[model samples]
Target: MDKKGYNTKGRGGGNVNEGGDGDKWSRWWWGLSHRKSAPSEESSNSNQVQRSPSQSKSPKQKIRISSRSDKLPFYYQNWFLVLLTLMSLSCFAFALFVFLYLYPDSIESSPSSTSPASSEVVEITYGTVLKLMHEKTKFRLHSHEVPYGSGSGQQSVTGFPDVEDSNSYWIIRPQPGTSAKQGDPIKSGTIIKLQHMRTRRWLHSHWFSSPISGNQEVSCFGGDSESDTGDLWRLLIEGSGNIWRKDQRIRLQHADTGVYLHSHNKKYSRIAGGQQEVCGVQDKRAENIWLAAEGVYLPVNGSE
Candidate 1:
């Protein structure tokens, strides 16, 4: 047992020594062993430091992965652009529909939309002076001056303005209202009769043959002062003259007969002198075109 204890003490490098020289050798050996163990511990710490970064980097990589997943998908990324494009298209469609629906009539009535030959027509009013002219010879419509005492007399249209005949001016009186008092508005579709401003006679035509033009019927000024079918005439605006622009032509059609008021190249006798006798014909001619303008104001009565 004593020898075993001696060996254990010797392992400490002369731990059995009791003198100064022995203690010195023991301390030196112990110092050498401690120094060798310290280097190994330092190597282990350096390894731990290097492994720490790799261990912590796993969570950091996970954080980066999660952050990337949090972003919206590529398909949904441009949601704002998609919504804006849809809204813009919808607004444009709505505006286009509104424009087309609101102005349909305007588009149809536009001059560019209508046929080249067709034109817009308008209305003609009362108190219009119509100058009946020959298609070949332009002449003013005239009536014969009544004798000193005559109820009604023969009438003819003349182009000669040599004498300013008041008979040339005829007042359009709508038969619906009072002869000279309550007058109705004269329009393209209105049924009217003309009265001689001076003779105070309404233009009347019968089945009688014209003395001058044996082929056509004669038109004379004679009818009831109130109203008569023979006196009623239908007024129409020529081709495109219904718009009532200045110098528009008018047409007079006999109500009793389908003939139009026409003057020929023939010369006829009249109270005013030699004038063109107005006749009624079935065919339309250039002479049938008549100009209308505001004429003398003939009062319905003394107070009117």
Candidate 2:
């Protein structure tokens, strides 16, 4: 019994309160401690339960997130490559458009236009504008203002390799006293005149020798109003038809010199480099054959 009414027991030095209020206080402390200890135990058990699930699932969630994060850059890289390809195609298309807009004739006079097999054959009539291609040498009858360094010293005639040359064009005309008119289909033996489209000169051959072959010199002489017997060339059709056709091969014999218009593989080196010589050959041969090519063939008698 002490002043607080608690017994200080001797066996293990314990304090046992004896009064009713002290007993009540002791019970309250015990109850409070029990309640605190109960809450701590429950909290510890709850924490263990929560930690078990989180720890178990953490590695799976991390794997999924890491996989998505790794693939995200590749997905964006694929989209970037697609956009880059589209932009490159757009730039190429724009460049092609600009090129076509600038040079229209480059498309118009392409190899397709000059191909005889591809073009529609129309009647070659008087006053028709045409290019005569040498069948053997594959050269066009080309004339320029550049005069011959030798021979007659007139405007020189040469076989040009290019299909798109505007100087290769020739306008067909009848002889001075002929009854033939424009748009009339030419007969096989019809004597005609070829006027150079660019220079307005007549295709003429005379007694002078050629620069290369020493055959009769073929030159472009006279102007728009000039007339001469040397300008006449008689058309000799090789095939069965007397009426001239675009697909038929023909020869032009100079009425003055009686030589066929001819070309060969002989290329000039100086003034007209890489160009074959156009001259007059007395004997009818394969090199004299010419075909109508790359021209606006007029329909016979204006019938389209």
Judging by TM-score against the true structure, name the best candidate.
2
- Measured with C-alpha atoms, the lDDT of residue 5 in candidate 1 is 50
Cα lDDT of model 2 by residue, 265-293, tens digit: 99999989999999999999999999988
List the RMSD of every prediction in angstroms.
17.5, 7.1
Off by over 4 Å in 2: 1-84, 108-119, 302-304
**On a 0 to 100 scale, what is the lDDT of residue 3 in model 1?**
56
Rate residue 168 of model 2 by lDDT. Answer: 95
lDDT score for residue 262 of model 1? 74
Q: In angstroms, how far off is 65's CA in candidate 1?
A: 99
Predicted candidate 1 versus true structure: per-residue lDDT over 95-210, tens digit per residue: 98999999877666543332222242322335544334344565567665533122222454345443234566666666655443332334464577777666667777656555
lDDT of 1 at 35: 99
lDDT of 1: 0.60
Best by lDDT: 2
Worst 10 residues of 1 by lDDT: 114-123
Pairs in clash, predicted candidate 2: none
